[model samples]
Target chain A: MIEIIDLTKQYGKFTALDCLNLTIDKGTVFGFVGQNGAGKSTTFSILATLLSPSSGTAYINGFNIRSEPKAVRSQIGYMPDFFGVYDQLKTVEYLDFYGASYGISQSERNKLIPQLLELVNLTDKQDSYVDILSRGMKQRLCLARSLIHDPEVLILDEPASGLDPRARVEMREILKELKNMGKTILISSHILPELAEMCDTIGIIDQGRLVAQGSVSEIQQRLKGEKLIVVKLQHGLDEAVRFFEDQPMVSGLVKREDGHSLQFIYSGDAEDQVQLLKMALLQNLAIVSFSEIETNLEDVFMEITKGVELT
Target chain B: MRNLLLNPVLNKEFKLRFRSFKSFLGLGLYLLALSVLMVGFIFLESQGSPMGRFRPEQSRTMFILMSFIQMGLILFITPGLTAGVISGEREKQTLNILLTTNQSSASIIFGKLISSVSFLLLMIFASMPIYSIVFLYGGISPGQVLVVLGYYIFTILVFGSIGIFFSTLVRKTIIAMITTYGVTLFLTAGTAFLFAVSMSVSQMGNSSNNPFALFFVMLNPVMILFSFLEPDAFSELSNQLGLGSEFPLWAANMVTYVLIMVLLIFISVKKLRPNMKVKSRR
Candidate 1:
């Protein structure tokens, strides 16, 4: 439900967002992956109507960000990377205040507050002062505040940053639940694996430009050339090594630190792999285990951003 | 107008301000200072009089003294209350989220100015019993007391708008506070000094009416209060300046201040909008 068309933002001579174009469909969780100062926050701020793009424009739910900012704001919820809570406000009061800011009625906020607190697992702490909450809890409260208006889209800038591992998992689960509830989320995080697991589509941004955008598997397939395979033999390790060495598909082979295993880079299809296994069995090598090493999101990201410099 | 006044920013500000211990402490300190001044004035009046019988004219002077003190307190407290309204939000990193909401920049500015003015009004109202002390000896009427309170309200509007204007212009709260105080001091004291200098210059020259001198002093709230307490003096000055007008001096002063306050608030609202400068550049 979000579309950014040739969006460029320049602060004097330094460009913050450089001719970047992206789109996220309705009810999809789009993970924005980038390192520090990679224009993720700038893009989010532009979409949220908190910053004007130097050139081009964006739209959310069919409303232009620059021209119809109020409508855009009404359709989107934005949570900044760092924010402060009012000292004397309670959790419910904090949400109530934002609800009113979005022009949500009192009755609707009263009904929505408890549901939001429960969604963020902060229902028990709803009566506590916002300043007294832990950082992770405060982050969750911020998420709830963003949802107070029940916007169709959520623009979260590093929602899981600075959280403990467990809190990160909780946040991940909450985002997953939000996805199930059909909210289109554009979440930016440097953590690659989490985004891989949570996102339907992932876009990598570098130096204000989107370097890569696709599904995780699609990116992996695009970057994958030679697949790494490991073979573990109970006895007949020499026979397995010789078999792999003789195979034309096996380009390079190395013995594992364990005395009984052989690892090799194989450029082969599934049929070739099956034939190699059949040949191993025919050679009477006691194969314990054989598996292909999967390429992860981190590897894909590193391969894509290898020579990139900070802008 | 109703929607503009009853905004989320105002609602939250009122709640946070009144609920904090600082509000109570500020009120207590304010009353204590006023009480000390009232008692000191009573002591001086008793000592100056023959039989401990304070005259009604002395009570009138005391009323005027208390009004000026209240005005001074307003001048001092209002800037401190409003100088951080926008810059504080920026420091807290909440302005982005606030701007992303449905609340307009005008609403936020109005809400902030009104809330700060409302707190100052509360302090002024709480000090009403101090006015009763002056009322025990009858010289100042209730209407006069109300007029003084109305002037205090006008002063709050002017000073509070100045604070908000500076707050939006500057990104740092400390700098905003300092600039607000500097501007306020210039308006209250420096303007009167310039008026005095202009009057002396006019006296030395051809003795013609100096509209600059009259306008400068009229901009000063202290001079406005003097004109309110003594209309004949303002009229005589106006007649001497060959600017005899249908409107009273206080009315003219209020109009001028109201215009200035509106300008400050308009600038503040514009500045508080995110990327407004960037948008304007396009």
Candidate 2:
């Protein structure tokens, strides 16, 4: 459980995070999506209790990040964006060090570490030196380190970044297992579709502001008016474009470079779309196929951040 | 306090440091240097004497030289050991994750300082058997050796704290090391230079006593060690600087170093935070 309330962070005149607010309930996975210089990492840093906000505060599992940072730290495990492994230490030793830092007893750590290594699919590499491991293994080791204390919440910043496709899938599978274990996870990723599959909800932040927040479909539904329609024509592509431009719901039309298809923003509902397609057929525009493009999380993110529909 | 001493950072540091061949190599090289100093000193003494006949008083000179060399080694090695403690963590990007754990900032700083100093101590202790050569000469008492050991500890802590302070203040390890060496040089040599200049100025100005010279001389660790090792020469210098008979210069020097070490440790703990503003419960 995490609650961020009106958190503002200012570095002189530049506002890294501006009066932002967010909340993630227990057992839910929240994905933070933002471009570089956006406030996602800044927000995660604040919630991780590493940086103090200039104004306002956050709470993790009912512990105030500002007033009760130690409690907050105890409740949540944090994995930063970069891999921070000590090259000289073996994987198990590395995990043990973090476990000890969290005050986990030797017996408990001995038990927990094997379970953690299994969770991250790093059991065999337990005895291997961290430096010798591949990037993916090191990342997984970092993940295991975060989970060493069995914290109720996880704050993972770009955990899947820089991994190869297979490693990324492995990471995703581990996250899915974590989701099943009922851990409240806060993750951020540049890979939108992977995040869409892993997160229960995604929050889009733009230029230090949370522009959109909801499930992927919920965000797409909110931007329903901006749905794009692709029309394939056997002939009279120019004529169809002119006809579609005259229609009340059609705007932002662009001809396909292939010269056979065109797309336009369609604001009408399903029935209205059918009626418009019927009119195009009646005009003898030689329409071969007409379909609406399903907006994915990437589209929603772009639409929100580009000062388009969500703004 | 026990938890602080056995903190995970210290344990990890010990493992990381000792597991490497470099530590043992460094210790071996250190002892070799000390052995060479002894052999060279013995050769020069025997060369001057008839058919290697030795004077017992020369052992005292040898002890003093060996002690000064050990002190120099401590001063030279302490900054290199400690100046990278925190900054290296930062470079490796592990400091943030370490901070996010339940370990307090003070524990991290203290653990690092102790770990580095412990390795230096191990080297110093390992050299004790080598010091048996001096012991066999019968000029230096065991009490004097213990006092020298205690002085080495104080000097190590003082210089190590200075290194850690800079390590916390700066981000780059090389920069921290440079600054640490700079401060150490100033404390050791610059203070002595300032004392010389102050005494010269006092002599030319017809002033019998200069507080500046006294202050500078008292702050110099080398001068303090000399006060204990070569008291007659130190007294002449002390008298020239108008030092009173009320307090031993070495004790006053240790107190001054203790105060400085405390202040540096305090500042280091505060500055160790990645962000200066680490807010806790109101």
Candidate 2 lDDT, tens digit per residue, B1-282?
788756999999999989999889988998998899887887799789887854657778888888888888888999999999999998989998998899988899889999988889998888888776876767778887887888888899999999999999999999999999999999999998998899899999988778898888888888888887777898987787777878877877778889999999999987765442453222
lDDT of 1 by residue, B12-68 (tens): 999998998888998899889888988888889889889987788888888888878
Task: After superposing candidate 1 on the true structure, give the runs of residues whose Cα lies further than 4 Å from its correct spot.
Answer: A226-295, A307-311, B236-247, B275-282
Task: Kindly report which residue stretches of model 2 are placed more than 4 angstroms away from their true locations once superposed.
Answer: A229-294, A309-311, B274-282
For candidate 1, what is the lDDT? Answer: 0.87
Give me the displacement of residue A102 in model 1, in angstroms: 1.5
Deviation from native of the Cα of residue B23 in model 1, angstroms: 1.4
Each model's Cα RMSD: 7.1, 3.8
Candidate 1 chain B: 10-residue stretch with minimal lDDT: B273-282
The lDDT of each candidate is 0.87, 0.87
Per-model TM-score on C-alpha atoms: 0.86, 0.90
Q: Name the lDDT value of residue B10 in candidate 1.
A: 93
Residue lDDT tens for model 1, A1-311: 99989999888888888898888999999999988998999999889887888888888999988778788889998999999988899999999999999999999988999999999999999899999999999999999999998899999999999999999999999999999999999999987787999899998888788888898887777757657799999998887888889998785588999899998877788888999999889999999999998867786676566533222
TM-score of chain B of 1: 0.91
Best by DockQ: 2
- What local lDDT score does residue A65 receive in model 2, on the 0 to 100 scale? 82
